[model samples]
Structure formats: C-alpha cells, structure tokens
Target: MKNFNWTNIRLFLIVGVAVFLYSFSGIRNEGRKIKQAEVVFVDNENFITKKDVNKLLKQNFDTVTGIKKVQLDLNKVEKSIDTNPMVDKAEVYATIDGKLTAIVVQKKPVARIFSGSKSYYLDYKGNEMPLSESETARVPLVSGSIDRTDKKRLSELLNYIYDDDFLKKNITGLAVMPWGDIMMDIRGYDFEVVFGKPINIDRKFKNYKAFLQDAIKDTLTENYKTINLKFTQQVVGTKK
Candidate 1:
C-alpha cells in the first residue's frame, strides 16, 4: 500500500508462530490423555479367584524393593504362577488401551492325606500337592499307615476314589495294610470297607453297591462292623 512496515510484520509473524506452537503442545498432551490405558477386566474361576491372583502378583512383583516402575511382564508372571502346585495353568494379556487381564485354572483335590508330620493333597490326576492350612477342614482326611502308600498304589487308590461316588462321599479315612490291602472307614453306616489290594477296586465297589442296595433296606438296624470285599465277587459283612 503506502510504506511497508517490515518491523511490525516481523513481530506479528513471530507472535503467530509462538501461538501455533503452544496450541500444538496442548493438542499433543490431550492426545496422550485420551490414549491412557486402564485395567479393564479379570477372569477368575476353578479355585483361582481374582483376589488370589492379585495377592500373588503383589507378593511377587509389588513387594520387590528395586521395582521403581510397575511395568508388568505378562509372560514372566504367567510362568511364575504356573509353578504353583495348585495352578494348572495361567494366562495374562493386555488390552489395546493397555488394560491387563489374568486368567487362571486351579487343580482340584481328590483326597487329602495326612502323613505323620505333614499333609499331602492328592489331585484327581494323582499328583500330590502340599496341603494348605486353610484347606485342611474341607477335604476328607486319609489317615493311618500312609507311609506304606507308594506312588503306584496311591495313584490306584485315587482312581478308585474318583470313580466311585459312594466311596468318595462315605469313606472318611484309609489305612494301608502291609500286604497292600486298604481299610476304609465310612460315614453314615457304622462299618469299615475292607477293600483288599488296589487291584480290581472297580469290581469290588460294584459288588458293595449291589449288596448295600438290598441289605441296607432293613437289615442294618444299627450299623455294620465291617464289610469285606476282598475274596472273589462277594460282599461279606459283620453286624454292629
């Protein structure tokens, strides 16, 4: 137009650049806030509760003295959890927004055995786990001469216990004889099941079931002292 004001123009351009930079910085911060991650979900089942998982994580990770950051290595944590005897498997994942998730499966106890100083928990697969004090009362106790129970025989006995519903419920204790015979103390009826040898327990259980179905109708006014299922396919009982 009239005279070009170079100084004013330069000043205005500088102001504009500063304003744009400030606005861009604000936008960048807003984007970061929008993209922030959150803990979205947790799945707990089969004796592996969310609380239990959290507790374990805290015990292993959070309690570490030098861990300045809360960066979670999911694979490492999952591997650590799998080492537990009760944990069958464990998985950990992170969501798109950065939420962490954990899933776990726990071992089921088939029978709890008490050997002298310590207790052993036997799973359905016959894997032995250390007995926890908190779980002592819930599972049935296996007492008497547990030292005589070798791995093979224990596995066989566990298989028998898992298959027979009556034995699972009624049998309270197990005593292993020197000759590999098993004596069981049952509940409800006042009798012990003299189950000889872990071999052919299925047949013996079937025989016992058949006999009780007929005999317990009115014959057991009191209780049976012992029901021997040792010889052949017969169920021999002694009255209390």
Candidate 2:
C-alpha cells in the first residue's frame, strides 16, 4: 500500500512538471520578436504602395521590426493605415513565424471634379478623393459651379455614364450650371448636351439614344449644335 501511494504522488508531480514546461514554451514563443512586415493591396493598385503602409505602421510603433509579437496593437496599426485618404479598408495581422502582414483596399474614383481652381476626384462613395502621384484615373472630368449638396447626384450620374459602353466612350466632360442645370460634352462631336436636372436619367438616356441612332444613320451627326433631353418624352436637336 505504501509503494502504490508513492507511485501515485510521483505521477502527479510528473504531469504537473510537464504542463509547466509546455506553458513556459508557449509564453516564450509569444514573446518572439517580429522580424519583417509585408503590405498587400487587394486591388493590386499602386495608389497606395507598400512603402506608404510601412510608413503608416511606423507611425504607431516607430518600427515594427524587433518588437515582440504579443506587444503589437494590431487594431491600432490597422487604424493608422485607414487614415490615408486613398485607403478604403485595411486589415493587419501577425503570423506565428514572426511576420506581420497588412492587407489594404483602395477607393475607386469615378470622376475628376474641377471646381474653380480646386481639383479632386469624386469616388464611387460620393466622397472627394485627392489625386495620387502614382497614377491618374482615366475618368470623366467635371467642371463649373458645382454645389456641395449635388455630389451624390453627380456621382450617380457619372456612374451611370461609366457603366454604359456607348456613353463611356463618347462622354468626356460635364458642367454644372449656377442654376442647378447640367451639360455634357461628347468626344469627337462639336455639340453641347442639355442634360438638365439629374432625374429621369433612364428616360433621358433612352431618348438621347434614339436621336443619336437616327442622326448617325442619316450621316448628320455633326449637323447639330445642341441636343436637349430636358423636354418630356423627346430629344430636341438644333441644327447648326
């Protein structure tokens, strides 16, 4: 009975020692220093580069390398990258093998707005996006007396034009009048388009298409000075 009791006590001590050693090893691994970081853009666009993300990450940690894995505030690191105007979203994580990774998504600009001398891009979200030194987006340009409140409508209008291949290839510029009216310019055509208010977009576009198809079929596309779609149910073209 004495020998059996001793064996049970020895087994318990052995198990306890093994558990302590395992936990110690895990703790030590958690303290391992990060050796490198990699930034990946989901869209693969260079509007925001890896160097830019590295700078943003450094803003939080000075230098991310050589820091213990458990000491990094990943949420703060992600938030830092989110502050960039070009970034739409960002996610950051640390690997067990001492590598840090950040995945970034960038905003998409639909039109470049030129209000007076101030120029900026209007993104798909209807927000102003600053131009990048990396690359210029090949989007339509908007000019004239643009009201701040009209941004959402303008963005929608630009999106509609961009989605249609015919309109996207022909329409190059838009102008907002002081009285809240809109105008458009077509590529390779010497005519102005009276777009009017941004409502009834589908109907207006359909009417314009009918007019355009007839004008092209008749070989009189350049015979017009202005095409008006503001009138109800019809597109009015004024001969030059």
Candidate 3:
C-alpha cells in the first residue's frame, strides 16, 4: 500500500512539472512574438493616439530599464487613457499577432463661454474646458451672472437654441441679469429680448417667434429697445 501511494505522488509531481513547462514555453513564445510584432491597427477615432500610448508605456516602464519585454496590461492602459477629460471612452486589446490596439472616443463640446476674465468651452455633459485662443469664433457668448445656478441655466438655454432653428441663427449674444434674467441680442433685427426668469421658457420663446413672424410679414417700422417675456402669457415691447 505504501508503494502504491508513493507511485501516485510521483505521477502527480510529473504531471504538474509537465504542465508548468508547457505554460512556461508558451509564455516565452508569446513574449518573443510580442517583441517582434509592430502596431497592426490604431483606431484613429479614439481620443488617445499611438504616441500617447507609447509615451505612457515609456514612463511606466522606466523602472525596468534594460528589459526588452513588451507585454502590456491592456485594461490598465485603457483605464489611464479614459481618465483624460476629453476622452469619452477607450478600449485596448492585443491582436493575434501580438500587436497592441487602442480604441478611443473623444467628448464633444456643445457651447463656449466667455466669463469672469476667462473664456472656456463646455461639452454636452456640461463639463468646462479651457478655450484655445487659436480656435475659430463659432460659439455664442454668455454674458451676465454666470455662477453655478446660471451655469445650469446656460446649459438649458443651449438646449433651446439647438431646438429652435430660427433662434439658433438669429441669436448672436446672451446677457444674464443680476436677478437671473436672460437678455438675448438677435442678429440683423436691431432688437433685444428681455427674457425675465427661466420659467415657462419654451412658451415665451414661441411667443417671441410668433411676434417676430408677424412683424416680418407686416413690414411695420416698430423700433424696439426691449421685448419683455417675463410673463410669457403677456408680451410687452418698449420702443427705442
């Protein structure tokens, strides 16, 4: 019985050793292939570039200065890239040929703001980004009290601007009042909208549209300083 038990133990050890050698050989072959393989594919739409990945790898691998190993934890690298504010999403993977690939998606900016001694851009998710001076002037400005509350208001206003095609083209600037009132300066019409309170905003916007349409059709020479829509049910225009 003792001899039988010893034989079983010896056989188990032999099997384990064989498995370990097989795995080790496979790993060594993989490493060699990875070292030899060049970048097979890069998803350009991904916010992160190949240069970014290379830079990150170099920075993180500096500790192993002399090592020629090219193995990478794709999940870890993708996580690092996704942390960037401009990157909406990122994915990393290795091809069958051992080439590393990364897919990145960039965040889209919805509106731009120039307030409090600095100009910034905001994404659709309301994240603020620093404005580049070299960027072309395309976004509308939000003037007035642009604090936390007003920031939210600005986002809402942008939604309205996107929905209304006429308003999108006609509006050139926005001025915020101390009491959270919004004043819009329309293009080419020589008139301003005194949008008091962000309440019933959609209704007030419709009213303004109706009034403008009527004025255009009638060809009336009514020079106005302010078109008040505080009470959306009632519109009052002050002549210049």
Best by lDDT: 2
Question: Poorest 10 consecutive residues of model 3 by lDDT?
Answer: 35-44
lDDT of each: 0.67, 0.88, 0.65
lDDT of 2 at 211: 89
What are the per-residue Cα lDDT tens digits for candidate 2 across 1-240?
A: 445688889999999999999999889878999999999889956777788889998886768899998888899989989999999999999887999999999998888999878999888888889999998987889988888326677778888987889998889898888888899999999999999988788889999998898999999988999999998578889989
lDDT, candidate 1, 7-69, per-residue tens: 999999999999999998655543331122122223232344455556655555534223322
Clashes of 3: 2
lDDT ranking, high to low? 2, 1, 3
Which whole-number lDDT from 0 to 100 does residue 78 have in model 1? 77
Please give the distance, in angstroms, between residue 222's alpha carbon in candidate 3 and its true position after superposition: 6.3
Write down the TM-score of every candidate.
0.69, 0.82, 0.65
Error (Å) of candidate 2 at residue 186 is: 1.2
Report the C-alpha displacement of residue 88, candidate 1, in angstroms: 1.9
The residue pairs that clash in candidate 1, if any, are none
C-alpha lDDT of residue 127 in model 1: 80
List ranges where model 3 is wrong by over 4 Å.
Answer: 1-70, 97-101, 148-150
